[model samples]
Target: MKSSGSSFYDRIYRLVGMIPPGRVATYGQIARLAGRCSPRNVGYAMSSVPPDSPVPWHRVINSRGRISVRSDGEPCDAQRQMLRSEGIEFGPGGTVDLSVFGWRGPAGEVSNDEQW
Candidate 1:
């Protein structure tokens, strides 16, 4: 089935929520999972997360294991703090260790049927 209209963002947010805490996933990975081509779209989806969302938006990062942040705001620091509280380690070079904390989501199933 082809997803379109307003549901696309909702679908992306649901996928983002599926990402467990204390682990991270790249934008490309999320895009692929969402059956989308552009990782930037995944980033865009994340950036549009609603104020009342329960999704773990902080768990998504760039392919290079760096947080994708807005150039001018406190949101960047908030993301870093949230990740740190989750015990996700960051290097002195300002990179997340995806090898250690990368999340592949659920192992055996691929469905929107699961809880968000």
Candidate 2:
């Protein structure tokens, strides 16, 4: 059987690959989708993917709709620039408007909240 690490990375990459140029997904969202991984694990996979990866690591943000800075103090300006180039505008506080750009999978809205 394939190792969980390999499978986890593969699954994370697959979902990340689906994020369109101007859209974004959260590490938490990706972790939930990948099932067995955590947000930290998703972050690790994002950082570990090969340089030529088609996963679009720049598109994965935090649940607050802001890009999470790298652990090495590497600023996310390049990622913000890349998103801007794709027509994704950021607010004054550097947060994306999730209501407008969030991709909630095939079913649309991705939440388990009850309609009370």
Candidate 3:
């Protein structure tokens, strides 16, 4: 049987992969879409992603729209650079305006009442 952790991570990867280039999603947003998982869990899965994985792990940020600081002292400069290369402009305060660049998940996946 597949481990629940692996299955959960797979689901997170699939969801993250759907975030189109130039758009971003918050960890909380993904957690809501991926029911039964917490935002922290999503972060954990993201941190565990393989260096060569195609999952757009750089597109996810905190609810405040900032790249989360890595606890390992690994700078988030690379993540910021990747997002910038994708045409995602960050504000002076370093937060992406969700209203302008957030992906609302797959069509019909989110409704007015469920908007993040």
Candidate 4:
């Protein structure tokens, strides 16, 4: 599906919202949840998140559980801080350990409401 407007973006946002605190999901995971074919679409949807939006955009990371962007400026630092505050551990190389902190979808069977 083509995510061309606010409704499409809203769907992506709502999916992101389902991600629990301290657990991170990959962009591909979000895309799959949103019924999107490409992970790039998930990134695009996140980039368009409004300033006042409550979606947990920071909880969405790459497949390897790494932040898409390195910690550089205030925003990046803030993102890292937020994750850390959630008890997400980072390796010595500043990479999150996916095996430990990554979310593997919902437990057991997928719920009908969770289906994209």
**TM-score versus the correct structure, for each prediction:** 0.81, 0.81, 0.81, 0.79
- lDDT tens digits by residue: candidate 2, 1-116: 44536666888997888777778888988898888658999989998989887889888988898888888776579999998898889999899987787767634542455221
Clashes per model (N, Cα, C within 3 A): 0, 0, 0, 0
Instruction: Please provide the root mean square deviation of candidate 3 (C-alpha atoms, Å).
Output: 5.3
C-alpha lDDT (0 to 100) for residue 51 of candidate 1: 82
lDDT of 3: 0.83
Which is the leading candidate under lDDT? 3
Higher-TM-score candidate of 2 and 4: 2
8-106 per-residue lDDT for model 1 (tens digits): 677778777777778888988888878887888888888788889888888898888888866564348788889999999899866899989888666
Candidate 2: global Cα-lDDT?
0.81
Model 4: number of backbone collisions = 0
Lowest summed lDDT across 10 adjacent residues in model 1 is found at 107-116
